[model samples]
Structure formats: C-alpha cells, structure tokens
Target: MTEKYRERVCNGYDHVLTIDERLYDVRTDHQHLLIFKNRAFGRVLALDGVIQTTEADEFIYHEMMVHVPVLAHGSVRRVLILGGGDGATLREVLRHRTIQQAILVEIDPSVIDLCRQYLPNHSMGAFDDPRATIVLDDGLHFLQTTHERFDLILTDSTDPDGPAEMLFSRPYYAACKASLAPGGVLVTQNGVAFLQLDEVRSSARHFNALFRDWHFFTAAVPTYAGGIMAFGWASDNPELRQQEATTLQRRFSQTGMTTRYYTPEIHRNAFALPQYILDAIGKTSP
Candidate 1:
C-alpha cells in the first residue's frame, strides 16, 4: 500500500476493497458503495467514516431487527426508524407490504450521503422509495415532538454514546410510548450484548418497568463491536406474536424477499436469555 492508497482518517474494517487510489470516494465492488474498509471494522461509509454494515454478516443484524417486533405486532403499517443512516434497516422494514410509511430520523446528513454513495446493495432501493421520509435531526427530539402515531418504532442509532445517548434515556422511552398508536411496538438497538451488558440490561429493565409489556431479545451480528446484539420490545401485555415464523414467512416472502436470517426459532431464541443475563438484569436491582 502506497501513501496515495491510504487516507488521512483511516477507520479500519475487516474487509474493504480499494477501488481507486485518488477516487476520494472509492466505491466497493460487491455493495457499490464508497467506503474505507478499515482494518478493524471492515467497512465504514467513506465520507463520514461510520461503519455501514460489516462484511462478515450484516444480514443477521438487519433481518432480526426489522422482523422480531414487527412479527410480534402483526398490524404494523406506519413505521418510525430512528438513527439508521446505513439504510439497511429501512430496506428491511420496507420488505413488509404492510408498512405504508417509514420515517427515518438520522442525525447526520453526511452519514446518509456516504451510505447512499457506498452501501446501496445493503438496503436494496430503500432510499429511492417514495414511502421513506429521511429527516436529519436528533431522534430523541423528534420523538418528543412528533404526535404522529406509528405502529412500530425501530431505533437503530449508533452506540450508546454521542448524539444517540438520549435515545436510551427514560424520557425518550416515554416519548416513544406516547408516539405509539394503541398497540404500537417499540424496539431499539440496545448496544453490544456481551460488552455492554449493563446498558442492555438497564435498557431492558427500564422498558420492562415502563411498558406493561416489554422484553429483551438478542441476535448475532458478526461485524458489530460484539458478536451478540440486543434489542428490546414493548407493548401492552408483552404478548409477542404467537406464530412469528408463519407470519414472517407468508408476509415477507409474499413481498418477494427471501430473507437470509430471522426464523421463528431464532425469534424465540433471541428472547431466550441465559441465567447469567437474567442474573445480570437482577443485579442492577434498585
């Protein structure tokens, strides 16, 4: 690698292809998106340097996220996605014909611009869809202000810091609940399951306390900071769909998306926590 091949701000990834030395915006071969596949994280959107999704396995993260709570609440039509600049989650969300609208709230225009230029394939034609509304602002603030009710709210923000920290706060959670229409479902990326156990458990505890029905679920995504990722859901009675597998199978594939991940068993197991995770939740007791 020559000096020209390297960048001034190199955020490494596990896999990245150098399209052009001086291209400034070098796009990847498989995804057709420009990224600096950094040595550590494998691929980040080239301009802003936010990891768009990883080479190892982005589907696991995307599929489980868009499906779980969705399948849990089958009547979903309007959806709100907070902080998914990558567009993968939006892509996954759009797969459901049941979804009439998808409002994506991302803080950085640069991230979306970088992703639109780089991670196109990861999200199909998500950005191009007329049904998707992209808003550049703080998600927490949007939730607090928007009285528009949604059937499902998916918060796929960055790690539990920076501009996204408030999304995990109690006030934001309350706002999310208020934004839900009747039996609305709320789900969020609860940080790395293994490394941020406290954050995950605390989030779950808070949700469990606030929502009459809420539970923590986990999925495996190889590219994330941790191999395991956790998400939480809340409703009135904590009643997840009885037949998540069947519903997803008929609805999603009907829309012509044969998903790589998200199965009924996986849906069940994602919520099935180990005793330690349970004890971990208990340890944080007040």
Candidate 2:
C-alpha cells in the first residue's frame, strides 16, 4: 500500500512525501511523532506535522553543524548539544577524537528512543559510544544548574515555538554564554535567512549583546526549504571563525573523516554571507 503525507513546514509552502509504509504513529507528551518509510527520503521522522530529518540528506545537516565549530575551535574537548534527540549531532561530535566528552540534553527521551529504533542509520551507534552522556532534561535548566564548562556548545533546537522557544531567548543565551569555557564557541540554527530574516536579526541582536564576536553562516539542506538555512555563530575569540583555509584543510585531513557535503573549502565559504543576509543581520555596508 502507498500513501501521501504533506507538511506545511513554513509559511506559504508545503512539503509532501510518499509513504510506502507507516511504521510508527503516536503522540508523545511533547508532540505528535511519525515514522514512515519513503522511497525518496528513506526512513522519515516528523514531529507535529513538521519534517524533522530524513535518511537521504540527514548527513548534510548533521555534518555541517557539528564539523564547522568543532574543526574551527581545533581544541574542542567537551561539547553540550541542546535538543538533538535524533543523535545525528552527537554522532558527528564523536568523530573528533579531540572531544573527550559529549553531553546531549534532550527534553524528550521518547524522541531519542524512537529515533534510535527507527532511524539508526542517522546515529549509527552513536548513543552507545563510551564518551557520550545522555541527559534527559530541559536544555535551559541543565545549563542553569550545571557548573560544567564546555569548549563548544551547539543548540540543535527546533524553530522558536513550544518548549524550544526559550532556547532562542536572551536569558537562555545568557546561560549558554556563562557555561562556555574561555574562548569557547556557540552555534544555533537561525532558520532560513531568505524567509525568516527576523530570526537572523533577533539572534544577532541577542548574541551581539552577550558575545564579543557573533556572525551568521549558511548551509543548504533541501529538507529545510526556503533557500539556505542560517546558523548563528558566537565566540569570544573572533579568529576562530576566520581560520585560514590551509589551517582548516590540514585539521580536516588530520581527522581522516570522509563526508558527503562538508569540505574545508565549503567551511570557509559558508561565512561569505549574501548581501541580503548581511542586511538582515544588520551588517549593511557602512
């Protein structure tokens, strides 16, 4: 049997995919979850009618988000990941041998369990890694109480809504800043810059206030429509984002990690924002 599932991921558009079989459908405490098999996207996961990730292109988003900051810092020992219940982010973080510990704070444990059962390819045994510590708690509360310092913090959160809305707020960002080790870096998903310009501006305003250096970068994930999605970058040390191409290339080669979408050259180019994005982040020409 075949069926069609449609999702309104953003304003004025819909993402439709064919479901070869319905694997799991239930309403978790946080949101409705659906797991299905699709020919194009392979295994698919959705929450509250929004596509979370797909097996076909999950690597693109996960690799770019995890590698850019980790490789740039060049000394990331501990990482704090917010809302990455899918474990793709944790999978990428573990690839770096420099990382000593990775703590994943996910509010919903069911998302983790379900994703592990259905979309194991995305995580690929990352949860069982010895260095990983899974904390089933709210991201903000975990930051508020933990005295631990991290060399890198990555917020793999959903859009500004529901429980995740505060993850983009000033207070939560303040908590994140306080939790970072000196010269530590923080990054967040800022939505699609082409359609969600306000998100970019708001993140810039908040991050600018708390951080000595802040900027935006872009990555194209076809699953996330509306042009290229932006990631918010903040670090007390500005030079981290401006590492020379040769330096990045050497570090990437040292890792000996093969990737499908992220390259050292692409890492450098991701920061070369378009003029419109520059204007949106209030970086217009003087």
Candidate 3:
C-alpha cells in the first residue's frame, strides 16, 4: 500500500516531506503531533501542521541555540529551557561541564515520549541525564511561580502562534526576565525574519523594554524552509555579544566543542544583521 502525505504551509513556505513510515499520529490537548520518517530529513516531527525538527540538520539548530550563548557567557551553572519537548536543547545544554542543573519546562509530555521513541538521535538520552529535571506544565505559570533563578534561559519554542503564542508575549518576556539571575542571558527561537517580520519586530520591542541590551543572529537551517533562521539574544549586559574575537576563539577551543554550522567566526558575525531586517525591527544598528 502506498501511504499519503500532506503539505504544511508555514511562514509562506509549502513544506512537503515524503513519509516512508508514520510512527505516531495523535491529537494532544495542545495540538496535533505527527512523527514520520523521510529520505530527505530522516525522522521528522511536526506539530499542528508545522515542522519542528528533523534528524538530518537538527544539529545546526540545536548547536547554534546552545553553544552561541554558552560560549558568549563563557560560563554558566543553572539553565532553564521552555517548549523544547524533543530534548535536543537540553541535550546541548548539558554538554557544558559547568552546568550543575538544567530545568526543562514542556507543556506537552507526549512530545517527549514520541521523540524519545522515534527521534532518538535528536535527544540522545538527554532526558535521563542526572543534571536534567523535566517539568510537565505550562511554562508561563512555572515562570510566574518558581523562585529559582538561572544563569541562562533558552526558549527553544515553536513559532509565535498556537500554543506557543504566549511564549513571545510581553508579559512572558517580563516573567523570563524576573526568573533570571543577575547577569543572566535569555535566548529565543525567533523563526525566519525574512518571512515573520511581525514576530521579530514585536519581540524586539518587548525585549528592548525589558533588557539593557537585545540583539538577533541568524543561522541557515535547511529544514526550516526560509533563507535563514533568526535567534533572539537578550541580556542586561551589552558586552556579552561583543566579546573580542580572540577571547571567543580561546573559550571555544577550551570547550573542545565541534559543530556543523556554528563557529567562532559565525558567532562573531551572526549579529551582523542585514539592513532590511534592522529596518523591520526598527533598529538602526546591529
């Protein structure tokens, strides 16, 4: 029998991946979840008709999300991750030897189980790491209630729509701000700036109000179906992203980390935004 697949339209891109096999399909309380295998992207996970991550290039997305900030910060102990149910972000966070604790707040537990079973490579048993604690609840509510502080908070969430809409809200950004320790940094997956201009602009406005310094960077993820994926960088310290090239290179070398898409040079240049994007975000400079 021949299996059929459907097209998912997101950010004005029509994405259609061949489904060699469907591993799971269910409607969770939050949204529809689907896991399937394909030749191009290998094991694929999609939520609410939008592709989340793929086995082929998942490293590119996860590495950039984790290493850039960790390297920029130089050292971190406590970390919080929101909306990354697949555990990929957690996996990368635990790579830092300085990390003492990692708290992951995922609204949907099913996403974790399915990803564990089907997308094993994405997480690579990161859930069972001694440093990780998985919280199955609303991220906003957790942030509002938790008294604990973190050195880094990474919102590896979906696009600014559906269940993830509040993750990008001003109040949520404020909560994230309050949840962080002094000198802490917060990063977010801001989607493709070329297509989702409103998301980038709105996020920039809120971040600018809350943080002393806020900037953005880009990474080219083939599966994301856009020119480049933008990551949001915000912190009270203006010097965090402006680390000298020599310092960053030295720190990166000490970590003994290897990445497919992220390098010291890329880290240095990621913040170099194009004029159109700066204009869209109402910024005159990088």
| Model number with the top TM-score | 2
Off by over 4 Å in 2: none
Model 3, residue 239: displacement in angstroms?
A: 0.5
Ranking by TM-score: 2, 3, 1
Residue-level lDDT tens digits of model 1 in 126-155:
988989999987898898788799998998
Deviation of model 1 at 12, angstroms: 19
Question: Which digits, one per residue and each the tens of the lDDT, describe model 3 over residues 144-251?
Answer: 999999999999998877889899999999999999988899999998778777788998999989999998999999988767889999999889989999998998
Q: Cα RMSD (Å) per model?
A: 5.8, 1.4, 1.5
- Per-model C-alpha lDDT, please? 0.71, 0.91, 0.89
For model 2, the run of ten residues with the poorest summed lDDT:
277-286
- lDDT of residue 65 for candidate 1: 86
Comparing 1 with 2 on lDDT, the higher-scoring candidate is 2
Higher-lDDT candidate of 2 and 3: 2
TM-score of 3: 0.96
TM agreement with the true structure for every prediction: 0.81, 0.97, 0.96
Off by over 4 Å in 3: 1-12
